[model samples]
Target chain A: MSATDELVANNARYSEGFEGPLPLPPAKKVAVVACMDARLNVYGALGLQEGEAHVIRNAGGVVSEDVIRSLTISQRLLGTEEIVLIHHTDCGMLTFTDDEFKLSIQQDTGVKPTWAAEAFADPQEDVRQSIARIRNSPFVPKKDSVRGFVFDVATGRIDEVV
Target chain B: MSATDELVANNARYSEGFEGPLPLPPAKKVAVVACMDARLNVYGALGLQEGEAHVIRNAGGVVSEDVIRSLTISQRLLGTEEIVLIHHTDCGMLTFTDDEFKLSIQQDTGVKPTWAAEAFADPQEDVRQSIARIRNSPFVPKKDSVRGFVFDVATGRIDEVV
Candidate 1:
């Protein structure tokens, strides 16, 4: 079987009899914003169950305007009362300089890099700034809680940032 | 050894000499925004390497305002030109109603649920709405491309959402 096929088989075996949605315990819904690096498993790290929390991820886990808009809706329309911002060490976002990324794209696709240079630098600072921005954003519930943490890719340990 | 320790050891054994970052093909400096559901592995599914793309994840894979702001920075500063939104089947976001979540929090922490009902609801709609919102948001790069896909938790096949 191909790798994809093997993956599918594994999912079937592990998720068998998982009929539809699982029961959710009565709790205040929590939302986590984290990076999508494959190495980090938020569920395992946070010890969360299927119905425990909402997670949103984007590159660098930097809170963007779209993230804030969604957060607004999630707070105003959904049920999330708490927010967790999780960034990680050894992240891919930290590896590339903007110029190097652009050159790679140009060489691969023959498309000159049209993107600017400010987007991919210093991911840790970006996450810290995002946490501050989100905490101060008017869209977030003024009274709701927000916390930030960094997950160590090598250690599998999470360190609270603020 | 504890389960976590054993798992970490296995990861180290499997990943030894696999360090120094994954290579990025030029045209694929794409950013993936996905959900944090354990059933989905974005990198394995997409056949991506470490530096090829930045993976951002959270609940429902919904694009929030914060995500948009981050995307803007990524495109303008980091050289990323595309966005992939990946939502998966059997997501935990879909399993709970607002009341149950609130009550669970109350029971666990002995604290009253301060948030109202509007904070959390259907995750599918949340994902769909997030896609539309991101596509139309002014914060995203004008030339940047965005697409949405639904990942089958059972099959590992990602189907583009039309």
Candidate 2:
């Protein structure tokens, strides 16, 4: 069966016990931007539930224009006031650089895309950069409430990157 | 205490019993891109475990350049072979037009963002568009393995968008 087919079957079981109809806004009024790594369960790790917070995931959890876009809307429209950025240890983002990756992808597919890899050497430093990016942006409300952390993939421990 | 203070406190309890050391690559070899809606639990809804799949999320799960960048790395560097694009009903993306929203943000913050909201009139159509974007991108490998879905926020049912 297709992988999605398996997900569909999984969802059948999930919806059989689903309890939703949650409000439009997050109950805790926070938005979390984290990595897309499979091992890091953002909700379980951060103690979030279905109606608690908006969890935004991407390659490295780095702050990009799209992230800012989501944050702007999340704060302005949805009443989310706090922002948390979480990058994890042993991230695929730490594996390569933009130049080398772009070169490699070009070699692999004969296309030099205009996208930025947003790769970083240290996850903590990347978290710091992401926090600074959000805090510095005028669009994001409640900038002082922004926090950054590095979640250890090995231990599931989240350490503040201060 | 602050909102994040609560998360930090909650996480302390979570880490005490945390179990991990999962591998860097996803066991299921698939990446699921979905919305940043707080009501949706990407992991639990799809029955994905800690080491199962990559979950990339943004405002609308729209296929942007950065998403392609991540998917390229996910497929080439990591072993992710299938891609799933999930958009949800009653999404914030269905709330406004890019033109009006950009004007509103510019008025609110005195800065004009170059980013597009990628908003859509319908969730299913947006999912289809996202799947097509991933399939059309030169960077993404295994395009034929892509699928799309519209997850119902109220009932927690995920219907295939085909």
Candidate 3:
């Protein structure tokens, strides 16, 4: 079976015990922008319960325009008051620079992308930068609570970016 | 205290019992793109354990250039072979039109986003469209295993988009 088919079968078993819908707004009033890294369990690492936060992830957890778009909706519509940016150690994003990745993609498929990969040299610095982006965005109604962290993949501990 | 401070405290408690890092590659070789719905527990609803999948999420789980960028990194670097897209019911993305949201944001921030929200009227069709986008992308090397699903938020059941 495909991995998704396996997931479907697993969902069948999971939904057998389904109770009811959780609320729309995140209980903790926070939204998370983190890396889509396989090893980083954002919820478990941060002790986030199911309905406590909105975790939005991308390649590097880099704060792109799309992240700001999501944060806009998250704060404006869903009542999420704070944004927490998390980047982890040994992320795949740290593997290549934007120009390098774009060139590779260009060689692979004649199509060049306009968007920057938002690659950075340091994960901690990336988190700090994302925090700054969110803090400076006019879209986020509650920017004072925004913060960033770097997760230690080895220990599953998060250190503040400050 | 800010919500992020609460998360820091929570992480402190969690880190005390932290086991260790899971492997870098997803055991299941799957990457998931899903909505950042507070009520949608992507791991629990799909029965995914930590380290089993790389989940990329945004406001609508829309398949944007960044998602393709992440998937490229997932396949080219991290060894993920499969992509699964999931959209859920009662999505806030369905609550507003792009024109409306754009106007609202423009009014609020005086900055206009060039990117579309990629919002849709139907969740199932949105999943299908995202699946097609992934399949057509040259970035994803393993397009044959791409699949889509709509998770019924009320029942916590996932229906395959096929």
Candidate 4:
């Protein structure tokens, strides 16, 4: 199916009928930091619902500058108190070398790359490292809880990494 | 069950003794922008496997500063050539007025509120707006595809929003 068709199909299968506004929950303040891998469904894996947690995702589920900023806002501005960082197994971020990725893009688009190399290496270790970065980051409330996990995509399981 | 128990259960159910590392398809490099709402399971909804597409998530699935940064890296540095932004219904980001949220937080934490009225507002509209922002974003390749949708927490479905 075309991308648009796939989207529409998925939407039709998953979205229909509900029209009213959502009733807010009392525990409306948890956050999850997860990878951008489509295969790892954070909700189904964790058995969560809307308003139960705020999710933050990026490459490797690493706590980058953007994660810190959103997390800060989620906590200070939106009232979230807990954060769960979820990285996954067999991640693409764990696969290609920077040069290979750049070469593929260069061949596909013929455009010169602008970003540096250190950005895409060792995704698993990156997740482990991000946990420490987030824990030590000044932006996150010192008392706020932060935990890390690795989601095994094949098994629909998550392992606490830190 | 604890997270570890869940992992163990899933592993027992799904893992075959093939042990030489799970064989995965070549990463197709798609980007997914989804809500941090724990209820929306992008993986199960999409039937995705590990090492498939990249996922980017934030509040209301809104594209924030960090989302853009991640997108830049995903497209320019990583191999993603398409983007899917997934928003959802019944999102907490839409549930309360800024003042109400601040009041609730203040009452809970007993901290002097430094949050602003502009902090909280319409979530559905915000998600649609974020999709537009991403489509028009200079960081995203013009020819690279970008689409937006809304996942219904009640129905476990997603609707194309833009």
Candidate 5:
């Protein structure tokens, strides 16, 4: 079976023991922006239960336009107040540069992507950058407690990026 | 204490019994694009462990340009083969219209957002729409196993969008 199929089977077993139908808004009133890295399990690492927080993740958790869009809806419509941004050690985004990646894709497909690849050199620095992006956006209104963290993948710990 | 502080404390407890970093690449070779709903716990619902799959989430789980960018990197750089698109029942996206949401934001912020709010009326139809978007994108090469599903928040069950 494909991995998707296996997950579907897993879901079937999960539903048998599940108790859900939580309210629409997040219980913790926080929205988390995290990396899409496989090993950075946001739920487990943050001790998040189902229906506690809104988890928005992307390639590098770099606070792109889409992330702003997500956070706008998260705070405006859903009433989340705090924002958490997570970038982790040994991220795939740290491996390549934007120009090189876009150029390689252009070489193969004859079409270069217009969007910023959002590659960053350091996870801690990128965490600050992501926080800056959030603070600079007028669309996201709640910014009092926008904190950033760099998760240590090997140690499974997160240090605040102050 | 703030909710962010509370979660940070929880992370300390989580790290106490945590293990070393797993491999960077996803072991399952699959990427899941899911909605950023608090009720839809992707890890628990899919029985996914750390290092299993790349989870990309947004407000509505719409296949936006950023998603294309992330998937491009996931398939090209990280070697993921299958894609899973999940939109859940009772999603916040179902509550508003794109024009109305943008207009409200424009009124509040004095500047309109260029990005689409990506609100959809139905979860199942939106799932099909998201699937079509993946099929149409040239940037994402692996499309043979692109499947879409609607997760039921009440039942914690996923029904494939066929």
Candidate 6:
């Protein structure tokens, strides 16, 4: 069986003990933008219950146009008031530059991508960058508590980016 | 105190019992594109442990350009082979139309967004849309086991969209 099949089986097991249908809006009034890193389990690391916050993630957790779109809907429609951004140590994004990654893809496929790969040199700096993107966007209205963090993958701790 | 502050406190508790970092690449060789629904805890519902799979989320779990970017990195830079697309029932995306959402944002912000809101009438149909996107993308090379599902929020069950 593929790994997908195993997860499906696990899903069956999860549903057996599940009690859900929580409210649609986030209870904690917060939204978290974190990297789609496999090891950075946002729920576990943040102690976030299922209905507490809107979790938006992507390659580097960088605030791309899509992230702004998500956050706009999260705050405007779902009533989330605060925003949290997280980038972690040893991220795959740090391994390559945008130009290199796009060039390699272009060489392989013969077509260049229009979007930026959003690779960054430092996670903490990217965290701040993500925050600034959120702050600058006119789409997302709630910004009183927009904070960023660098999660220590080795230690499972998050240091706030000031 | 702000919700962010409370989550920071929770993070302190999480780190106290947390273990060191696991490997960077996903162990299960899978990447899940899921909706940023507050109640759709991808980890709990999928029974995914840390380091198992890359969880990419957004407003509607729609296959946007950013998702393609993330998947390209996942398959090319990392080693993920299977792709799981998940859209859940009772999502906020269903409550509004793209035109309505865009107009509302334009009215509130005095500037219209270039991106679509990605609202949909049905989760199952959108699941098919998401699957076709990955299948058609030249950037993502591995497409052997691409699957889609509609997560039932009430029952915590994910029915495959075959």
TM-score of chain B of each: 0.77, 0.96, 0.94, 0.73, 0.99, 0.98
Indicate the fraction of true inter-chain contacts that candidate 3 also forms.
0.75
Could you tell me the lDDT of residue B87 within candidate 4? 70
* lDDT winner: 5
Give the per-residue lDDT of model 2 (tens digit) for B1-162. 977899988888988897878889999999998889998898889988888899988888888877887788788888999988888888888888989988888998788888887878999888888887887888887877888888888899998887
lDDT of 2 by residue, A18-110 (tens): 877888799999999999898889988888889899888889998988898889878877899999889999999888899998998889889
lDDT for residue B5 in candidate 4, whole number 0-100: 44
Of 1 and 4, the candidate ahead on lDDT is 4
Candidate 2's TM-score reads 0.97
Off by over 4 Å in 6: none
Q: lDDT for every model?
A: 0.57, 0.86, 0.84, 0.62, 0.95, 0.93
Question: TM-score for all predictions?
Answer: 0.54, 0.97, 0.95, 0.67, 0.99, 0.99
- Candidate 4, residue B47: the lDDT equals 50
Q: At residue B6, give the lDDT of candidate 3.
A: 79
Candidate 1 deviant stretches above 4 angstroms:
A23-28, A103-124, B1-55, B58-162
Over A65-104, each residue of candidate 5 has an lDDT whose tens digit, in order, gives 9999999999999999999999999999999999999999
Off by more than 4 A, model 5:
none
How do the residues A3-43 of candidate 6 rate in per-residue lDDT, one tens digit apiece? 99999999999899878789999999999999999999899
Error of 2 at A130 (Å): 0.8
Query: Which 10-residue span in candidate 4 chain B carries the lowest summed lDDT?
Result: B17-26
Considering summed lDDT, which 10 consecutive residues are worst modelled in model 6 chain A?
Answer: A126-135
lDDT of 5: 0.95
TM-score of chain A of each: 0.79, 0.96, 0.95, 0.78, 0.98, 0.98
Question: DockQ of all candidates, in order?
Answer: 0.13, 0.79, 0.72, 0.28, 0.92, 0.90
Q: List the residue pairs that clash in candidate 6.
A: none
lDDT of 3: 0.84
Docking quality band of candidate 5, CAPRI definitions: high
All candidates: CA RMSD in angstroms?
A: 8.9, 1.2, 1.6, 5.7, 0.7, 0.8
Model 3 stretches astray by more than 4 angstroms: none
Q: Which one wins on DockQ?
A: 5
